[model samples]
Target chain A: MLTTPIPDAAETRSNATFDAILWALSRPGLPRNLPEPGEAALIEALLDRECAAYAGDPLLIPVLAQSGARLVDLSEADHVFFGRLLDAEYLRACRVGSDLYPDDGATLVIRARIGQGATVRLTGPGVNGVVELQLDGLPAGFWQERARLIRYPMGFDLLFLDGDRLIGLPRSTKVEVL
Target chain B: MTLASLTKPWAPMSYGFLDASAKRELRRKMVKAVCVPGCQMPYASREVPMARGWGTGGLQVSLTLINPQTCVKVIDQGADDSVNAASIRRFLSRVSGAPVTLDTLQADLIQSRHRIPEEILREDQVLVLQVPNPEPLRSVQPNMSIARQMHGDADYGRMWLQLYEQIVRSGRVMQGASYPSMVNGRHVMTPSPIPRWDVPKLHMAKHLTILSAGREKRIFAVPPYCRVEPLVFDDVPYRVEDHAGLTCSRSGAKGFFMNEVPQDDGTSAFELSDSEYGVKSIRRAEGDPVDLGDTWYTNGELTK
Candidate 1:
């Protein structure tokens, strides 16, 4: 009889991080707790040598490098990490992917304060109805720019990080700045 | 980075039978699948010990998600004790040491083939479905490239025409299992080969559902509270199987999906399709204290 394999510490952390990420994405606008703070857990759970990633924060470069993902330009990257947003130029450059293959769209992880800034209403598939969320530290007109750039089913997905808290906004969500 | 920092101590096998890289890839794909709701995302379906078409897709997802803390439940066509379900459950437990449960209420992750549980799944639970064919456009258009374009364009007119032809020929929609449903009002996906009775349980439900096809190398999702509308004409209504009124001969349960068994008298007898639910019903009838969770169907009708 084969003995059951046990998960090491790293495996446990990655699994928990992914569980949180999946939950946050499945129910948009809801806040979920990650295994740890910041994007380290995200990189550990998602990035590998097969991925192309772009890091906006210099401090995250070493961590990304350890993951063995090819560092590339913002447009070419499938996963892009923005530590803090001072401008909205990167949103325009982000890959929305083509209609034929929307999975090619980039997953953008940004640092922001949840529950404390501009109140916006979200209505989408995951949302039960209209859910209002307060997000801070984003550039001015972020929602408008996102709406302009996205064509349904072909837009990039967003993950906002605040310490250990996470909030996901998929392309299907309609964000109305209130 | 030094070698010691880059690698860990060697083990006989990975925790869940898949290497770290495979799990990472699946995690990325799953993120994208959840983001897009019904859009099919292609991924590298790594080989497991099982055959391609025998719930390998669901197995892969379950393996990626399983840990020692997770409670797992596996079902094949609603029966928890079938050869396929039993072997898969035993293999999962053996590989990961995750606790196995026959009760749906206790399961954190439920892997099913051709049926969803009759009990209402909580918000924290995840449902992984095994799909043989992920594409709903295959029957209408054989060319995959054209089919992809049709999906991109949301050109489901051909799908409607096929249903129209079916109704014209049979006086009702002839597509029995794997009924095509619109997800998030954007993409049409085959919710595996589940009977029509199980499809509504997915629509706007309180759990996350992921459908994967290992042979097809496709994965899709239906997030909680997402719209899942079955294709139907304006004049015609979507219909489930006529098993709502049937009672289980063995468990004495009524008003739920059932399996029809042929009797010696040329008549058909019914038994509950969800084996665990039936067991609970039987135990309750025997005066045992069994706590049955609120089911999706009550009195042969979908409530909430």
Candidate 2:
């Protein structure tokens, strides 16, 4: 399903509820395109490694290959989350198939190690100003991988994280790459 | 619509506050259910403000999918008076102000417990089973890794052997509720204590069948038009409880799902603990067991 970037999900249901919501609500005048929070949980999800997918993010090659996580490049992955905002902790593998047999192929859970706002601010989609988040010690193809997953209106989304906060930029969110 | 009109009665109405993440999560799993046939989606269960066993999972789904346009029915043990069912129905009716149905014929979304209703469900209706435990593997084996691998590889030969062994020891298959089955030759799931009779209904069912276990914290589905077969062998097939001549006392119905009843006698007499309604019907007509055409149960007396 294609979108216009103003996702209502992450705005209300970010994992780390306290800081993420506080930060998003904190900026009344700023564009509300900030990342969600809680990296620890996202990381735990990935470590579970029940599924792994390249929803459209090619830059995931370095991170995925390094982690020995297989690639399930489902072009039709419904709920896409692409951005440097991955928590890598709370993230568990995404369910790819039916419920009876939960996707054991490798579920993809998102975690944020670093985010965009440390040096840059990401604002678009549901943003009022700038969403704060960043990632550090990323793979060589981080930006390229992040860009690769962007198939506007059809690709997944991203939750770029910086310490405790992150921005949710779905594929249709129209990132300026600024 | 003015603010007064919007808050006129109850319900969040159209454009519910489910946002999108929760919907996406639910929808993602839902779509996968349609795609892969009958697999359980281990979703990121969102904690509803409601406590456990409160149908939060079902409420969340209803909030996400149903708006002003939907009519919902929530039943427990085929009755609307059940507090859990009523609470859930009230939540949806108040939040979405959708109509509630006590009759099986009037529901658009039927959230059920224990029974599938004697009435046939229509295609327009979406049946959601309130599951306390989604995994059939939980009963036989506790390890999830093994269960996951078992489901992935369809290693349910053991489940069948376990039941068959019970039949050997006793005269019948000793399974009561949460009978396990293979949905589309994959994904071993609990057909949710809806009776072995309901088990057959799941096979090639017309409407979408979604099972949510909030306390167990997992959601699974069986898509429409998929084949769900109870595991059996060429020699021994799926056996429904043929309690010979059992019936419910109040309803005068036999060969139905009967709940246990403790008799209030001065001296404790351990007899068949079926509901009183079950006994009346079975006693009236003297209903006989439906032998598996080929006599699957041959060891004991048929009427005992």
lDDT of 1 at B109: 96
Backbone atom clashes (below 3 Å) for every candidate: 0, 87
Where is model 1 more than 4 Å wrong at Cα? none
Q: Tell me, by lDDT, which candidate is best.
A: 1
- What shift in Å separates residue B274 of candidate 2 from its native position after superposition? 16
Q: Candidate 1: DockQ?
A: 0.92
- State the lDDT of candidate 1 residue by residue for A103-171, as single tens digits: 999999999999998999999888998899999999998898999999988999999999999999999
lDDT of 1 at B57: 95
